[model samples]
Target: MTDVSKIFAPGGVLSQTIDGFQPRPAQQQMASAIAAMNDDAGVLVVEAETGTGKTFAYLAPALLAKTDDGERKKVIVSTGTKNLQEQLFHRDLPRIRDALAPDAIVALLKGRSNYLCIQRMDQFISQPIKHDPAVALQLQQQSRVVKYWANQTRSGDLGELTELAEDAIILPQITSTADNCLGRDCPAYADCYLVKARQEALEADVVVVNHHLFFADAVLKDTGFGELIPHADLVIFDEAHQVPDIASQYFSESISTRQLQDLAQDMRLLYGTELKDLRQLSTVADQLDKCGRDLRLQFARDPERGNWREQMRRAQVIEDSERLADTLDRAQAIAKAALGRNKVLDQCYERLVLLKARWQQLTNTQRSGYSFWYETTPRQLSVHQTPLSVAEKFTSYMLAQQMQWVFTSATLAVNGSFKHFTDRLGLGSAQTLVLPSPFDFAKQAMLFLPRYLPAASDPTMAASFAAIAKQLIAHNHGGTFLLFTSYRMLNQVAAILQEQESSDRLILVQGRTSKRELLDQFVDAGDAILLGTSSFWEGVDVRGDALRLVMIDKLPFAAPDDPLLQARIEDCRLRGQNPFQDVQIPQAVISLKQGAGRLIRDALDTGVLVVCDNRLVQKEYGQTFLASLPAMSRTRDIAQVTEFLSKD
Candidate 1:
């Protein structure tokens, strides 16, 4: 018998480690499949439902894979978020190793920015105030706190500074970036914290990373950190549904007005003593800043949400963008003439050169298989050139690396088809497995489709959603997540709930506070209604009766105006396909699956999933969305839903 079956048997290690652990057939099956995978099998795509113990199911077999000489095989376990990476590294992996593989070594690696650069921090502290003394004074105060921690910390991770909050202005100045890092030439190269972390990852038996970092290393080649994929024997992706979007973002070319301004500011600071030519350089910086401001205003004239590709072709827009690029080129020449062999100045000059290159790329008409667009943020404007499709390149990358892959997530399939996901990654021929959750969903949960509501796009839909949500909260006595697709809807529904004459129930809305604070309030209130949007849709877990209902305001579809989505839609149309059915509907189906999964976390947990959009029941594709959900009891009867919630 295999080690997998022996360890997963009735009286095995897991049962002993976890209290009252029942042997799950689904878990055992998944472990066996993972144990059986070889290089010849290529990739394995597994859709393990919510309660299937997926983390352990894969981790157990991965831990057991070893050479006959008893050397541990190197493995990379990549998750979709840093929270899960922390959980796996600090919590789950240790417990599993203690119970199973006692000698195993595991390391958690995050992006370079997550760690403090001792060199950068020291330089920041020693430098005289050149710009903004108020900001300088704040950094000086914070550096004292950081200095003490830097001496005591082995990891140099910023996460250890509990007193410092995430939004602290002091962080960006102290952290290292690829553009700013001097690499081997830095004075503190021997003691660099980020270099030490990478060394540890290189030697560890198992490495934990988030998807963003993994994709960066896999494709972007120059993510500052060296290659990780070529060194791994196997790569496992948890929450694999998020890979396509992250890949799209990492592979694209982006340059922003903020980036240009930062380069200019850094150039100003890199020079130590004031040169006689300082006034000339300062004037050039100011002119470039004005040009950036003008470019921002030009983009803001059209507030339409999506790609501004056509707008970029406008004669005035083209002239202005070229002028902005020219101003920067002139500024670069002035700086090169003023500054000597200073390393800091060299790095800043390189950034200026790169920015110019991106501008040339953005405005050039020769590039095919790419979408050129511009977007505006509250503080700045940006330009992007994204590939119309990354499928071919991604597939070639995976094959070139020659590492066997395992991709698992609860939300990978739509209407029992894996084509939506597989095609996106160009893995149509990979081995596939669908393991349903062992939870008795028919008894443990119910799908409630509220009938006869306003269209999801209607302005008054928020009021109707609030009315239904209010009734459900009254019936269930709280622990509800009122999820909206848009911030406008979220705010409107929140206001309506506030104005309604109902019994006092704690209501926590997103953006009112930090996400951590909101979740803490929700869990502590125990009977509170949490109003949120996209970020709250997934990666949230509230087990048992504390989260008894998940009320989604509409079908979770990507906005038609999103630049990336629009590009994908046009690509599909040009190929003579139904973009709505093949692309849009499948994508939304997967999102709905993720949102509905917040409930029924454990075998005994129960709840009701309420989708307020009547289109889910009226549209022809409604059944496609409905079929992708767990096989739970379904109904439109309000009384039935009320009774289910009212149960003890």
Candidate 2:
């Protein structure tokens, strides 16, 4: 340990110790690695297991590296979710600041829209919202949540409103768009949260931000990283697995049909009249809104939206989409041309053009690497595609930056090789290490793939899942995560499982009780079955046997009929890359690995990882999936599963 680490030792007055929060070996290793970066290498990729205090591990090195002035020179920490962003900003940053330098200025910087837009908010407050449902309910509320929050908030970030439901609040009414911002000249500029946060970031020794903001700053060169970075000597990235995805998005851009609709809303705000301009912008907005609704109606609507049955109409879609695409393209140009004369109008128009272009390119491409999809809500519509690789892009810009770059995640490596991600991030010859989770996998978890089951898409598969549920239900008796890829599948299986069991049980589904509350209920109950999907795959932690049986319905493969998947696979084939091995199989393997990870969260945690898909035994690629997981003994026999669960 260095002098700085010793200063934070348990007995030292300056010790940054959390009571009962014992640090891990990986934390120490990571700290050593970060320290090594000052003299040795610039990049380090670490796979910190769930129980590893990875945050502090990286933070230790980060704190040690802070210039003599403070901890906030050019440190940019990024993560996958907004929740984590708040966690670091509110919790970790303070602890680090107190332990290191009290004067260390650390600021949390999010996107522009997070801050309250006084211009937009004024429009929303004064006028009667036309089509927005959320605004309707808020108009009745005497509390005026947006106004109250706007009054108190330093950031104007709508995210701070934990009490507000996303459906109950209109984001645009409070959030500012980049183009619509009145800059420093506006009346609200003196107390602007965005400006304050920016000023803090510019002055701080440590700046905390998300991966999205970091990439946007680098690519757009818009949010002013230039002011903070050049004077700073080092940069640190946390939750670095998400960097590539965010990096690519920043490199490219998206404009959606929803922009036109927003433009109309903006016109309502700006014109403060009957929208009498030759622009017909409001009418155009109404047309775009209707066009989206009509075009979406062309698809058989799935209430859950993820359903292939409701969404997929193979031959019929191409014809309908072609005409829709051309019409959108023409409208997009009109919106853009109109924007040149009007600032707010221009933002709305540019937004539409970008969406139109994105939608057309993604679905139209037959190339390898990219995936496209049609995504929409009643008020908004967008088509987006994930880039095949951002490796070249990331490396060309940031690779040569002579500073510490740390990428740590629970899921980054596949089959013990970091190459899948390493190649993608273009971290050529960077120091790479996969720190095996200290959790005792053999004792903590058991792998189970029930004997019966058809393919995921088979009509009869739901019935088979119900029968298997009976046996698995008997084992945990109720404290189990019945994870599904489809909401309909979960609803169907939940209906079936209810018929067979007599045991007292609590059932919770995603989005019903709020994820945190549902988790609270799930954790408190003596017997519970929490049914969830994608969001639950990685984060949920029920340590020390509260969670025993992790029953995956089937191997999670990307939906074949998905517009995005279809485009990416075709694109890959054109490039001569094996879509299965290069993309699909590897991607599925990562997701499965994340789901399986829920089983063993702690050293004492023990459970059965029952992957109900028999394909693990039946197919050649099954081995690939199995090989992708952490080292744990496997068995084809149900006797082992029962024996493992039978333990008190």
Give the candidate number with the greatest lDDT: 1
**In candidate 1, which residue pairs clash?**
none
Question: Model 2 over residues 1-648: C-alpha lDDT tens digits?
Answer: 345445434564244355555545666666677666754237788887676777776665565564445433366676777778888879876776677556656777777767767766775667755656665666546237667776787666778777677555467666666545656545677777777778877776566777776676676533222322232456666656566556756665444555545655665554455335645555455565666555566544442223222333466555545655665666666666565666555655555565566566645546445554456565444555556566777887764565567788887777777776776678877788777677777666667766766877788887887777667668764378888988888888877777766777877778777888988998899468888888899766688656887888888997776554454466567768888876677768888988988878777777887787878889999998998787676776887777777787
lDDT of 1 by residue, 392-449 (tens): 8889888777777899999999888899899878898988999999999899999999
Report how far residue 99 has shifted in candidate 1, in Å.
1.7
Segments in model 2 whose C-alpha atoms lie over 4 Å from true places: 1-16, 39-41, 67-73, 100-103, 129-137, 221-236, 248-252, 273-373, 399-403, 452-458, 562-575
The TM-score between candidate 2 and the true structure equals 0.84
Q: Residue 198 in candidate 2 has what lDDT?
A: 80
Give the worst 10-residue stretch by lDDT in candidate 1: 221-230
Assess candidate 1 and give its lDDT: 0.82
User: lDDT at 346 for candidate 1?
Assistant: 63
